[model samples]
Target: MTPETNAWDGAGKRLYLQEVGTRDGFQMESVFIPTEDKIALIDQLSDAGLAKIEATAFVSPQAIPALRDAEIVLREIRRQPGVVYTCLVPNKRGAERAIEARADELNLVISTSETHNIANLRMTREQSFAALSEVITMARQAKVPVNVSLSCAFGCPMEGDVPADVVLGWAARFLEQGATGITLCDTTGMAYPSQVRALVADFRQRFPQAGLTLHFHNTRGMGLANVLASIAAGADRFDASLGGLGGCPYAPGASGNVCTEEIVHALQLMGYDTGCDLPLLLLAAARLPGLVGHDVPSQLLKAGQRLDLHAPPADFASWRDRALARDQPQTAVS
Candidate 1:
């Protein structure tokens, strides 16, 4: 293929993508992934050139048995330079563990909806904020960057629509607590492109100093659409899982996060630089079915990438004539 014909030849635009397959992707899985396999997969992703990777969550083994090996996974993976390895810390204890594990960043989550917060976090909205405050403080002291994810920022299953002010208010408090960054999560995939554009705009206006990361789900099949809208709204970062392997355990009916390769392929087609090796990401995505023991929702996995064109049939020149003859003879189904 000529240089002009190649889709990946240019760095059109820069977009930062954080791979969360190891943490969010594995948490919902019922099958227990062996630590060695998990380490192997993470090691493979490490060389994919992602700027950040959420290596694992520091939740209790009882809460998420699939990620019980967070410590080992964090310790064993080959830490590549210029790559930030982050972990989810649900509380002070998780923060301490993340600190010991040498996580480059600690991700703290607090739902924006009171209903979702009580159900999933087992705490009131205020209570979750208060608790995460301490964790953020500890991260600051430990010299670990704190990224707070506001779950259900778009809409909630229980609560129909989330007001814009409520999300920004919560983010303001988290920022006041010394959070280094913020991630707006469409936990149930209720976010549309218009909603995403508006939210990102308001968020930048309200909290201009804090870093923003947009987390989306493909529940309603708007994941990549929302990514484009967000990018247009000046959102530079995103969280996507390999093979669409994530869902909220607490949020009923919530499903997988956006597929990594799907959006990566879309961005690459549009000339955006996501800093990832698409072939390697797809290779890693190829192994998810075996690890989780089921098929995943990856468009690229089923339909090959745009450039993977198939050759015409052996008797290509006769196809049109054959079809025309058949149609002419069978006209009107007489």
Candidate 2:
């Protein structure tokens, strides 16, 4: 293919980003971020031009104590008119709670890998699907959309090399069961660029009208590269977290999700319209370190943007003049 026709060319394209920090990220934090603080941060993110925000998970508080106040947080936060506020719902009860709390959407997760399904959800894939199907029906009755997130879509920690067909098979099932979208999750950061391109192309071809979102982790440092690949393969939506906070509890080597600010910076530089406010995102990311009480994996938060130039040393001009003079050839005494 010519350069113009290259699949990887995403210049001038529009991309949508969904912020998953408050729900996915905070669940992994050892110290629970205060409920008021969570609301404030999410309100900040709401104004940062994100298309969607996963506010919190409505699962059992015992399962994820950090997000125990999901109901309160969901109710208290100020919702931006254009942004969709979603909540993770693990079952019928969670879905009911999320709907009651006025979540705009419900995100349900089921792993494509059987071992991971058991490890994460403590149920077989079929059981999880059946259970989530009921949640989907309940959501439909409530007039809320459901987005199913397929974990280990790339590879599984316990059962490695989950086939692309198996991944898409699960996606197909969810889509057939009234899921409005499918988020292909690289649960352990196992996705590489080539793998992402192939699977995303297949998904697009088969499910052209379905909402496609890619979720990645930076554990192998391939998160941004994978995002580019997915974009090339026609995926325009992605899931990211501020400060790169989040990991799979069941995956041994799991790490944070792709940093939202870093992805926005890279995409904007490439001429893709991400619609996110870089400065606002950075400001929000900056608060994560203080809230989580530790440094985060967000490079943009640490190094600033690539074009954020620094002033030169005080003596640089004099030093350059002396160095240039020394390097100049001296004429022999003529």
Candidate 3:
């Protein structure tokens, strides 16, 4: 596509953002964020106009002690009318717990690579699908919408360079089995712009009615670039974390998920309506380092918005006067 034609196509269009910080971000934190703190963050995010928030995961406490208080956080948070509260469910039990906790949606995850799937879920691809199938059935019974996030969709740390068909095959299976949507995840930040564009185009054509969300990580610093490519290829939904606070243990050199504030800032500047309040998002992001007990990787939070102007230095007038006088030459000095 021509640059001029593609440049303005996404302008003035509506895009949906799924905030995965509290669940995905907190899961990787070394310290446990207090249950109350998690609730407060979710409440703040809800007020900030996030389209969807992955509040927490209903996995085994031993597996993910950081988010062990998932049910409590879900029950305590103030639910906004338009914001969807999603819970990541690992199995049927997790699905049951999520539904009991009154989650608006259930997000299930699987990987396209068999090795990665076995490593993460302790099962082969078929085994993982069988277990997830039970969860999907439970969600259907509970009348809750299910969105399956296919991890390592773009490439796998273990297997490397997962084929497009493998990713689409998993996505198609989930959609055929009653999933409300599919999130193509770059689990290790291996997705590039051209690959994202090609895959997204094929996905849209193959499943015209299926809902699509792109999940990216900034490990290789191409997360935002991949997002732009997806947008160019007609994918508008994405999963991003606050403060860029998440990484995969299985993927070496994995840093964090794409920062929510940074992506929103970029998209807003590009004229896309993300439906998020950028100022409020920054305010929430500013509190992340304190909660996580360390500095975060949010570039926007570190270096405010592009248009946030700064005044001149205290001695700027004297410096400018000296420089001006110096440049004027000695001819006028007499």
Candidate 4:
């Protein structure tokens, strides 16, 4: 489909798409996507009009070997104008590496569950916060924007039922410590629609100016439902991966992120402008199965759109007449 020209107004109605294929999507894959291919994907996504792209993570290679080429990928990627390239940093060392890479933004993740936090980062909540503060300070010094993500904010696979107070308290502290933005991450795909609405509503009310983003996984098939709830609760930013190509290696049964093309298609259909090129996003999703050696879960990429059936049999003149008639105003007959 052609890009929308006068389709969206520039105002509070705008929705932002943050493409996470490079970080979240590729991190779970066994195959090693060359740094050149990673850079090429970022260039294509930038041209597709994505506002932000999580380019890579500066974590330990032992933790996630797929992203070991973070520095090379970040340095080689073509930085498009108006697109914010971000990197995930796990600790002070990771933050230092990201700073060396001259990353545009640094994203830090902290878990709400004590057990998950200890298992994931080998630290207590207090220790994680302390490390996050240091990383935020380092990013500030390097003039890079710092964003903190609260993982398992909805529910934890190990601990189960993460309380709202726990999430809100952590968010308050992160903001107090100078977080430029905050993302609520459903790390294990256990969040429900009602829970999403309540959390986002409370957070938006408390932190009016906070740059709020939601990250959802489709493990139980509630990813899109949660996204709708968050949007209704005043969230405008969301995280999605191409063809939903990711999962939490630490959290068993956790699936990949919400599909980027699926989310973009939903937003465009709802008249909430995302500025993403859906046709191009479909092309990107189509490439994922071959690239990763598995079929992705994106519906739009597989089934195509209902509107795509408009000109079956390739009759150009007849299709043109039908299209013109559909676009014209309907009149009452005598």
Name the candidate that leads on lDDT: 2
What is candidate 4's local distance difference test score? 0.86
Candidate 3 pairs with clashing backbones? none
Q: What is candidate 4's lDDT per residue for 1-334, written digit by digit as tens? A: 1122232322436888999888988988889887788888888898888989999999889888889999998898889989999999999999999999988999999999999999888999999999899999988888898999999999888998999999999999999988989999999889898889888888988888889999999888898888888876767799999988787665555557899998888778767778899998888778788778888878788778657775457688898899999988888871
**306-332, model 1: which lDDT tens digit per residue?**
889999988987997887787675657
lDDT of 2 by residue, 251-325 (tens): 545458999999999889878889999999999999999999988888788799998999999999999999999
Q: List the residue pairs that clash in candidate 4.
A: 246-256
- Compared with the true structure, what per-residue lDDT tens digits does model 3 show for residues 40-106? 9899999887899999999999989999999899999999999999999999889989999999999
Candidate 2 pairs with clashing backbones: none
Model 1, backbone clash pairs (residues 3+ apart or across chains), number:
0
Best-matching candidate per TM-score: 3
Q: What is the TM-score of each candidate against the true structure?
A: 0.90, 0.94, 0.95, 0.87
- lDDT for residue 108 in candidate 2, whole number 0-100: 98
Any idea how many clashes model 4 has?
Answer: 1
Candidate order by TM-score, decreasing, is 3, 2, 1, 4
Candidate 2 wrongly placed segments (more than 4 Å): 1-9, 248-254, 324-334
Q: Could you tell me which 10 consecutive residues in candidate 2 have the lowest summed lDDT? A: 1-10
Select the stronger candidate by TM-score from 1 and 3. 3
Single out the weakest 10-residue window by summed lDDT for candidate 4.
Answer: 1-10
Q: Is candidate 2 or candidate 4 better by TM-score?
A: 2
- The model with the greater lDDT, 1 or 3, is 3
Ranking of candidates on lDDT, top first:
2, 3, 1, 4
